[model samples]
Target: DNEIKKIKAEYVRSFLFENKLMPSTWIVIRIDGCHFHRFSEVHEFEKPNDRQALNLMNSCAVAVLEEFKDIVFSYGVSDEYSFVLSKDSKFYQRQASQIVSVIVSFFSSAYVMKWKDFFPFKELKYPPSFDGRAVCYPSTEILQDYLAWRQVDCHINNQYNTCFWMLVKSGKSKSEAQSYLKGTQTREKNELLIRQFNIDYNTLPIMFLRGSSIFRIKGEDSVMPENGTFEEVKQEIILSHSNIIEDSFWKEHPSILC
Candidate 1:
């Protein structure tokens, strides 16, 4: 029996690949909604942007931060989110598959579980899912660049969608709206919103424009003692919608990479 067990174990183990991530490198796990376009249509998500949907995504991100202490920050837009784990993290022994799968699965389940809280009037039509991938960034600069790229993408897509939806809502067909927006620049889109829709793109909610950023910050936690109450500074997870592409954000929150 010992001989047979040894042979089976070797054969099984040979088929498995650990795919460990590199040490001393930041691990970014990005999760994207699978078939979210159709999911949005089926669920009748609001056009351009949906506050409830965005709120739900942020909530799931907050949950991820709370569960994984090693994750220093997260940035999310639309139906996707990126979680950044500390470079020196030993979570799951730095196995790529394990880390990605666990985070994606948890986010999907959280989205399902918390659906009612954000959309009490709407019924979930089907099980929503997400796909995840893990990538390693060897330096803080590269990681910041990656995040900046996502934020820029969010801005571009949101601007286009805002214009497209506005056109559609004003009696233009979807095809016509697409044609009108095609090849238009950022400035043109802003002009369109103001000229045709009387909407100032800058006046939109910060969350919609800049995307959501989740990170840990030092905050006060009130503690009750027999003598009196005192405030203790502790790390608390928070969500914000601010410009991360600039040096100011990093300068202010230096502990994120440290």
Candidate 2:
């Protein structure tokens, strides 16, 4: 019931911010779980291999999506599902809260029915390891960026690999590496950085170390050497890593692996 209310509040908040709600408003909603928990009696099924557990999570997502079909386009069911509204106008603005209310009710009712079938109420507790929440929302540029990054192959470039890995590692928490990179100061530099690190790049290391080919280098402050010395390049590469680590964003959110 509490969770349901929380979701309802989120829906209201989203609608209020969007404003201009008339009809045919396009929106995307997504929901997913962060972790999985099994009932005490289902301890044997607690491991990640339990198909039944996976199904239950999927079922929850499906139920939410089905109930909101009129306002949603497609939903991705994983740890989260996304809903894209088909219309461009917001005719359902007034009912936004009600929509969320229905979703909450659906979640509570579904959880009760599904959970009771496998274990007693007293034994029912979220699996000890799950920290994820089911989330739904309209599409945002952030989502697009995330999808694009996910599609890229990280293995081809060491810098790209490192940055990608760092993003994921940091993403385990709520810190905003993606947004920080997208910010104005770092946007252009970050773009070049990503390109140089991408698998398609001709010389990933050269691009990574030289920095000038990728970023502006001026005098002693420059990341690369005009003389093209291997030792200088190597030192620069090390410096780049250090600079990335010391970045205000990265520093605030250290890599989980580190």
Candidate 3:
């Protein structure tokens, strides 16, 4: 038994570096689809934004939250998703590599598992994979900033893709569309959408611009004395397609972090 234990410990030693997350800090795991541009084309994703793909992504995110209760909030847009764990969490011993790896693996599996629900008639052309990384933030404000960064990126990329595709749909080749959008600022992009394409950029879906976030809320069935009583807590995960940069969101869901 002693020899067996020693050999088993050696087998597990290689994984020591993979799952370690910073102690007493918030853990954020972000996963991105690998080479999804070609994947989107092959799957016939709608231009501007694909609602089906977005739904699939959101579903996967929800699945992650369900599997990892410590993950209090999640945000996703386009081909990427970010999961935020509580600062006091001890999941997977708070290993960065373990947390990131499992989230990415589970997310990818969920995506593939639920693809049929989103695209029943459309078969998966090939296996889809995702890459992930874990980042630590000492403050909640910084975590909020990370979310804001992703939302800003979503707006920028969606705007650019919308313009590029609209131009292509109007008979311009891919190269021509790229050239036309080159060096164009945000104002220029908006003008192009309105003047040429007759699109109301402001009227686009908020989900396309700001992405989606899942906030988990816990409600107890009965009240208990804080002095010594115990209460049952039921968790509810709420999905929101709203701007998370403002203080209103944070204020509304104060218990998420604690």
Put down candidate 2 lDDT per residue, 1-258, tens digits, no spaces: 999999999988886553233343344333334343324234445321234554554455456545554432222222333334444424255354544445545654675567655444345555332222222224433433332332221122233434444455545332454454443433444565556544333343432322110011212443645767533321111112112211352344232102
User: What tens digits encode model 1's per-residue C-alpha lDDT throughout 40-84?
Assistant: 999999988899999999999999998888899999999999999
State TM-scores per candidate: 0.94, 0.34, 0.90
Candidate 2 lDDT trough over 10 residues, lowest sum: 209-218
Using TM-score as the measure, the top candidate is: 1
| Candidate 1, position 217, lDDT | 85
Candidate ordering by TM-score (highest first): 1, 3, 2
- Could you give candidate 3's per-residue lDDT for residues 1-258 as a string of tens digits? 999999999999966565466788888889999999999999999986999999999989999999998898999999999999999899888877777888999999999999999999999999999999889999988888988898888889989999999999999999999999999999999999999989988898888878999878887565676777666577788888878888788888888876
Q: Which stretches of candidate 3 lie over 4 Å from their true place?
A: 1-19, 220-231
The TM-score, computed over Cα atoms with residue i paired to residue i, of candidate 3 is: 0.90
Best-first order by lDDT:
1, 3, 2
RMSD of each: 3.2, 22.2, 2.9
lDDT of 3 at 220: 58
